[model samples]
Target chain A: METPTYNTAFAELEELVAQIEDKDIQLDTLAEKVKRAKELIKYCEEKLRGIERDIEEVG
Target chain B: MPTPKKLSELVNEIDATIRNRFVGQAFWIKAEITDVKKQPDKRWCFLKFIEKDRNLITTEMGGVFWSNSYNQMENFEAATRQQFASGLEITCLVKVVFHKRFGMRLEVMEIDFAYEVGKLENERKQILERLVKEGIAVNPEGSSRYYTQNNTLEMPMVFERIALIASANTDGYRDFRKVIENNKYGYHFSVTDFSTQIQGDAASALIVERLHSIYKLKEQFDIVVIVRGGGSDTDFKSFNDFELAKAVALFPVPILTGIGHDRNTSITDLMARQHKTPTEVATFVIDYNGDFENAVMQLHDRILVTSERLIDRARRSLDTYKRIIASSSPETIMNRGFAIIRSNGKIVVDAKDIAVGAEIETIMKQDTILSTVTQKQDNGNTNI
Candidate 1:
């Protein structure tokens, strides 16, 4: 699979999170979507954390 | 007298004579036609009359009106000031017949037009007033307070398997079933009508019987429709009881009421999730579900569009990042005659990888350089 773009991956992560949170989503589909959302969240969080640490160290 | 037949024959003859004495006699007695149904031969008017219930048991009698009597009563009721329903009390002259095989029957002959009154309606209204006072029949404003909690619908498309809490075999049950099935979305309906008598002493019992059955199979339907033909409020008073009201309110699914009466709202109606004046709860069902379906579809569409847009944004950004990475690739740098060099199998930076007496190598864009180390330096202090 092609690696996701730095910016686009975060956007997809947000989208997946939103889908999980939406109340109207079917109950049966919640678990799988939530798992995917967590993975995306971690991926996005890792990227953001690295940037945060770099900024802190430079300052 | 001497030529009279055996005792059995004489007794049977007397019984026949007594029955014939009242067969065609015209007399007026007060009554109301609770159910007026058209049959193949003639219209059958189900009649009910209270005879003071001598033992305090409210008595009811059925009267069949073939044709002439039906027309008369129809016209009389239409022209009269009082309603011709269950709670309606009226004065009429009925030709009472004691059929040898069919027991007592009444053939209404003449209606005392001036005798019709508002006694039944008033009684029913008074009962309603009492129920209201008892806090059982809550007004609309008061009812709204009970709905302050959040109520989001879980099931999207509810399977409507209706059990019409009506009698086993009656036109009231059949007519109710027909009217509900008349609409377009009628194809998916599964209505099992327990045919029941509309108005009589048996009326309340039959209603409770049907209600019991529907309540038993509560999981099969989202709501139960208790429907009957338009008739006396008294005929359907079983629906107004606190027991029935509680049954409906506490039912697994919501109970819907289509019990007939345009102007009068029963305690059952107040307890139900929805109420319609006539025997067409499907109208309310269709409208309610239609609104629900529309909202769900809108939300579903929103989910799809938003997901697609997000995924698309992700894909486009990935494409741009790939392009930048490809531009800075090792093959591109090598083709430009630049090289990544190492000395003694390690990348050369500050020449530390070179040992004082060892051979060193360098990789250039086009060639390799080999040399022997002849100098040593520590923190810029050199020994040569």
Candidate 2:
């Protein structure tokens, strides 16, 4: 069985993106989402960097 | 050489009754042992027997597995022990020979060992180890690192996704499930098992090739799991190759291995982010995220604490401003308003500070009237 701990920020970011695209979001909410999105972006960037380094080592 | 008693002469003397020497090479003949002996001569083992058939055929034949071929014989027996049983059906490669002293002999060469299942497993392990040491990252899950200008290490936490590189349908699925799904912590993870022979001839190449395939999907995964289930001691040989270890050290996602066997550590284990005894790398990940949760919770608490502190500070600042407004009574200004007059564009602090003919004016909030600075007041005057 999957645990709630398995949900990464990516899932949250995807949700935010969906809300923006599908719902009428308030400007204040948009600002908060943007801030959260920046944090998620940072998380993704770190994940990708780790992958690159691993690929390089394997090579 | 004088023949002691020629079989043909003996038969003719008896009655010339034997027409032919063809004893009908009948192999279905049953025999009961009257005596069994190992001859002093190392070359052959002799058996004395009483034949039971249509006619009384009492005979003994020497049986031999030559010392030169004895090694092959022993190995063959060892391999086929699982299938070899008494009272079993028999089909062997054999030849019949006649000796001057002994009447007849049966020579058997090849014996079947029921099935060649294990033989195939071992050969596959050899190939897997060879491919790994060659410097190709056969197991796509391995550790990696990056650096920033501040010399701070940015270690991104990779979540529970690992591409397990192993043959599907083997013990891969079973072990992975036991570790990830059925654990007390209930760690969740997915395994994309690549089914191939775990051992024997084709195992090595298949494992390495699949490792390459998973490695290509680095962007899609956080880690890689190289796993196989418990088996013989030698079953772990596949992971011992240098190329495999090097591949693990260099994989895109950190490589985690749970090869199952507890023999000497393989090269892959040394190079991996973590090495486990089985596919329960999920347990490790769960605990890792457990720490992460504690950290986030602490952050949440600190935010609450800091907010309280900030609100307290703002309240104190607001109170200081309120006190200043309350103490500033206009009586201070009204005392000066009666004594001073406005002349031209300036306030006349005293009559001496103003000159005659200056168009002075008395001012109050109600009215501004023209006047003359006719008097001066003393330094300590309490005027009426």
Of the true interface contacts, the fraction found in model 2 is 0.00
Per-prediction fnat: 0.00, 0.00
lDDT of 2 by residue, B1-384 (tens): 875997756645433222233222323333333333433356333333344455565554444445544443345434432222222233334445444444455554543333232443354455444544454434344433211111121334635666767656666556675666675645566656556665543555566676778877767766666677654333444565444444555555666667665534455565564455555665666667667767877987786666556545544543443333222222333446653366777765556777765678766546768876555556677756
User: Relative to the unseen true structure, what is the C-alpha lDDT of residue B37 in candidate 2, on a scale of 0 to 100?
Assistant: 41
Query: Which sections of candidate 1 miss by over 4 Å?
Result: A1-59, B1-117, B132-135, B140-159, B167-187, B230-252, B273-279, B349-360, B364-384
Candidate 1 lDDT, tens digit per residue, B1-384?
Answer: 468687667557766886677655687676545544445255656555655554463666767665766766666555442335555556777776665556566767666655542543455556556655665554455343121011112332653677667654554566666656775554466877666774555555666676677767767766566776554343445555655554554455556666766655655666664455434566666666667678888987786666556655655654553443343444444677766556647655556666687777756666777877789867666643
Task: Give the range where candidate 2 chain B is weakest over 10 consecutive residues by summed lDDT.
Answer: B144-153
What would the per-residue lDDT of candidate 1 be over residues A11-30, giving only the tens digit for each residue? 77556555645656553455
lDDT of 2 at B146: 19
Q: What is candidate 2's TM-score against the reference?
A: 0.45
